[model samples]
Target: TEIFDGFSKTVSKCKFIPVVCGSSLENGGISNLLEIIAKSFPSYISKKHFKAISKQDNKEMQIEISENGNFCGFCFKTVLDQFNGKLSFIRVLNGEIKKDDEVLIVEKNNKFKVTKILQPFGNKIEEMEKGVTGDIIVLQKLDDISTTYTIGSKDISYTYAFDKLPQPVYSVAISAKDKNTEDKLISTLHKFSEEDPTLIVKYDPETKQNVISGMGELHLEVYFSKIRKQLKLEFETSIPRINYKETITKQVESRYKHKKQSGGHGQYGEVAIRVSPNKRGEGFKFVNSIVGGVIPKQYIPGVEKGLIEGLNNGVLGKFPIIDIIVELFDGSYHEVDSSEMSFKIAARQALKDAMTKGDPILLEPIMNLSVYAMDKYTGDIISDLNGKRGKILGMDPIPGGLTLIKAEVPHSELLRYATDLKSITQGTASFELEFSHYSPITGKLAEQVIEERKKFITAEEEE
Candidate 1:
């Protein structure tokens, strides 16, 4: 009793959290943990109000937490059941809810009928006719519902402000072992992503792979384990490829002539173009310098189209080219034989020739990375980042004996950083990264990337 009282006092003072060790699999210390929570945790009624956004006025407002008000709550979690379909777990913050009541999903602005109100106890669930304020209930068969969506009694037009999900740091490119099950695998992954907002699933068009990202390695492993157990399907996972770009470093002029004399009207088109580097991030620019009807106006679109298509695959590594200017200054056409198709071929060939001589280089995406860890592990963390080719920007000491280390690192180098950081800090740190900019890549590292790309292309062709 004395220990319980002391723990309660310390928790109430916001000094520390009381920890209760338990194993859910064995049901060890479960009852004691529940008892402590019931006795020590603050009641929901004690929370005065919740901040929410008014959709009508686009302003923030406070919603009072009272049992007499209209029904208001939010979905905190969701689960997919084979037999019951999607089940959304909601915490009722105000008023009451009954079976068949229509509720509004604030974010989606859609209404859904509550078919069954259920109360969960471990693995068992009991049907309830109604749920009152402060009760956590499950609604069955809410297929379109997702976590963090506000639920109100069809009248409130406010969305409760919820904490945002952290950025996913670890990623893997996944595919079904059997091609026949690929569609099913993708559909199931989407369902899982809907249930857990932190789990991100997307198809990378550049890499041509289905990628899934999450908080860390174990987080992804848990989903994969669940998927295997549920679907009984074979799956393959690999490290995702970084999306690199290509650009020119200098100006070069090239010419190409498309001509064929095997048919009645032989194709004929000739083009001269100058390619030069543009300011970074400006993307591809097309400038037509044709004068006095040289390279007729009708074929200009075809030339531009050809140039854009040429940018799709750079000579260095077949990566998309960016931040370059192509000037179509001179060309010749046979009035009887020249056509848009002929000009397109000529322009495409010209751009390819120019790129090969324009001092082309590969560009890799850089990420702005911020790591938070205890001060004692700062040296180890910095050392690891240095080894990954990370450029340290600065470090600031934060509260709680922690430090925030800021750096810019190439995206390819940090592919497994989530696991690496955990190992370096003994799982005592967290990090977030976002796309910063594209930087030039050269030398041995660039050679390795280009070689890997070649291997991937070869494997894809063989497949």
Candidate 2:
């Protein structure tokens, strides 16, 4: 057979043919033909006459034509069915699978039953009872199964971990249009994220909004469209807010007292705390430096807890506080009136007082940005980046007249950078951004941010 002769020579040479079969008298397809050659005629691709495709001539590549063995499947995508919750699309790499068979989730280290199996033909599905190696099948109601999970047996301890997708480069704040659908929106978002590894959904406590991020704006748009079609939920999305940090610069001492007198009992607690700035990114630190029972040991945790709550929002712009150390030196407490609640209040007030007097400042998140553009647009791209308060780090030239530009830019200035770059380069330039470090923002920009936050809060109150 001329087909057998051509396939044997191609495998021996290890050459990648663009189209293996065109107009032919073949039975099944190219895959079935390869299987026949591998199993029935393994000698056709003997090592003696083989050429390595990856330049690893010394390495032995096992070509197994598995017919009916242990169940080994790799899940790549998931589809939502009307009757069943989720149907995982899996390609059986080795072994045969049947309905009601139990398989081990390799990565999760859990066992799940294959409830109902189906074969996908285009957009339609037909009930399937058994599937062999190299056949694509679907299993119903595997809720916990996600993309790239290996479904196999415990006896055969082999798992395949696919390469992870790239991190999301764009984000937008999302909220359900109807308050009643908010819970359902979040649940559906999580389910969509399981199917698409590039989709990321997280809650931003700073702005009190749900954020959906992906590789680009279009990626998120597609997800939102699918959600609307499948779950019949509408969402409102806007630019995500920047999460700024607040920190102190100088050491300061603060003393606060909580005194309340009621008919039954009185509350009295006093605390003295020394606040100092720590190293950048060191976060918060609480130290108890009491001696001679000035402040009782039992109530010390109350002080720390109060201080932690205070750290959630700083005096400047109410942002999260970071890189600060608080030392509890000395304080006076009443034997009968002092309690954890009183101490907590006193500690909270003391920390806030210290921060206000300690020269608090606002810090904005910086992003490490890398832009790839053709040489013709490098100058324009760099100029546009500079306008966004970006600091150029370095530049490198590569083949095809492409230049790579690396820089650091503030996250606030990049909310719409993806769209702007596409417009500037006419869809020829691309860039990726990642969180770097927090840097201080001063003068007009800081004042503007505070003003905007106040307006946002006021609008929420009105609503």
Candidate 3:
């Protein structure tokens, strides 16, 4: 099993090994993966055991392997199978608890009891006591228990949390296959996400996707692959799309009047509003300027609610609209029929109409990327970063001709940068990424994205 090459002995090198096995229809690969883990994975004795830091003190607590060591287990990940209900998994670090043995799940200085314990195979069932150090066991029907919880003796008051994982750099629009299955899909996804700290789920109102995003594309691939067998749901997915936001470039004022003549009561609501773009990332703000009760103070919230809702669903091809302010400087509200509903509709209509005249802009996310590469390729690395619209922040030399480079670049430019990095650096480069502030998009790029979204909608509508 020893495979070595010139790359291994290279002075400047970045390395990673993926332990993987899988089969499309038949699932022997998972079994082989289990076997490999059993044979090669470090046990509690071999692993550097950790205890979460005490709440009262910043000091981290360590777990001792000796008999005197406290009974502690880390509930690192959780899985909620639709049929199986809930699976709260923990790795025993010191003392062990047997099946039917109750344990407390500690998190944020709060503790909850495990309802029952189950041994996991392809599926779950009752098992012998999980009484051993380093053994993994799962608990079921736990309501308050969650990931990163410590399970041990109550007297052992505290443990340290693990390092915070990197924030998710990429996102996609996701939703259940069907509206009827939305709740199940969400519950399943949340429980599945409990196990993997890296994956993040976000609801993007612009694209209207219940996006399940992870470190990279491959991370989410495993999640969707198991959705059916475990979660017991067949889901439909929207095409993955980047989250884009919309903002205004100029300020404008306008009025909207919703004068409706219905059978019983006529709805008449008038609003005079001014719209302006705020600083980036500030979100939305509403200023009530209607003085002397020209527009009743009570209806101010109605206009505010409408504007807030509009911000969520952008004016441009359903992107998230952000960084804007609206002021209700003057307006007239009907005492009889003018209510929050009428004012809300009027305000939304006013905003859309005003935005059409006011200059608007599309904004895209920028990413802060850091790369570690061999010193030999420093020159080449700098060139590549510039090509991706990246500005180098700093570079520091590491053990190898190995250099760490910090840069800020547009997220769109680096969508495929990970693969390119490996190829350019002979598979010896590793990089980290974070979301930087966004800037305005040029007319050409914004037009392109808008056209692409419209084309997709048109094609789907045709089908």
RMSD of each: 3.8, 6.2, 7.3
What lDDT does each candidate get?
0.91, 0.84, 0.74
lDDT value for model 3: 0.74
* C-alpha lDDT (0 to 100) for residue 267 of candidate 1: 94
TM-score of each: 0.83, 0.82, 0.72
When summed lDDT is taken over every stretch of 10 residues in candidate 1, the lowest stretch is 4-13
Over 1-463, each residue of candidate 2 has an lDDT whose tens digit, in order, gives: 7876776667556663434453345544767656766743435213322111111233433334455556678898887766766889997777788887888987677998877789998678899888887789988887778888878866655555456578788899988999999999998888778878888899988889899888888888898888889788888999998898899999999999999998767898899999999998788999999999989998899999999999988887788899999999989999999999899999999999999999999999999999999998988988998999999999999888899999999999888888888998898888888889999999999999988887887888899
TM-score of 2: 0.82
Which stretches in model 2 have alpha-carbon errors above 4 Å?
Answer: 1-72, 93-100, 127-133, 155-159, 226-235
| Prediction-by-prediction clash tally | 0, 0, 12
Candidate 1 per-residue lDDT, tens place, 1-463, comes to 7876787777866887878898999999999999988988767787778788899998989989988899998899998887877888999988899999999888888898887899988888899999888899998887667898888887898988887789999999999999999999999999989888999999999999999999999999998998899889899999999999999899999999999988699998999999999998899999999999989999999999889888888998899999999999999999899999999999899988998998989999999999999999999999988998999999999999999999999999899999899898999999999999999999999999999999999999999
Query: Per-residue error at 247 for model 1, in Å?
Result: 0.9
Better of 1 and 3 by lDDT: 1
